[model samples]
Target: MVANDPITGQGANGAAKAAAVHLESILAHGDRPFDRDFQQAVADRVREGARPVVQWTSAMLEPAPEHLLGLLVAAAELPSAADRFANGFDAAADFGQWFPDPEGAADHLASLAPRG
Candidate 1:
């Protein structure tokens, strides 16, 4: 499969790893992998589908909220519709907002932040 663009110059996998790592950091010692409550909440936030890691990063970056990794994990789990919304939001907002749906977000992110 063709590789996606590098988001933040980190490359696709790197971006994914970064997102995961960041989530781990945000989650901190309370739960190395994130608490079930947090995890479930994240799952709900995500639109509803599988998505690339960087796109997830983009979603988490929204609000530029602190301790973003765990939030990113949740964002990653967003639905296709929600991801798309966020991506479109970001593109229209000059990359300011998350995609409204996950698939759209993933596709949008792939276009903007492809792997090198």
Candidate 2:
């Protein structure tokens, strides 16, 4: 929020743009404004006399992906089949076998439920 002012000779023009960059990037989860770590990084950049890009993130508790990706990788996360498949067909060998969509787990659960 108004971290620098190049016009006023008080802050960096690029810093504002940088801030905007932080705001605009696409997000998954835990990548929003007022996030402790994210906020701290931006503030540190500003404090270091860096430029801002004027970006907006998805949520308050979330963090930037570039920063978060490392943490995710460190956690040894794996992509699911749903993530790999583009559509229903890539999931199975043929129609005879259930090519359950990786993302269709919830649907499978529903199907298994006893219907009246």
Top model by lDDT, which number?
1
| CA lDDT scores, all candidates in order | 0.45, 0.36
- lDDT accuracy of residue 79 in candidate 1: 63
Residue 1 lDDT (model 1): 22
Tell how far residue 42 is off in model 1, in angstroms: 4.2
Question: For each candidate, C-alpha RMSD in Å?
Answer: 16.2, 18.7
Q: How do all models score by TM-score?
A: 0.20, 0.23
Clashes of 2: 30
Candidate 1 global TM-score: 0.20
Error of 1 at 34 (Å): 4.5
Error of 2 at 23 (Å): 2.0
Top-scoring candidate (TM-score): 2
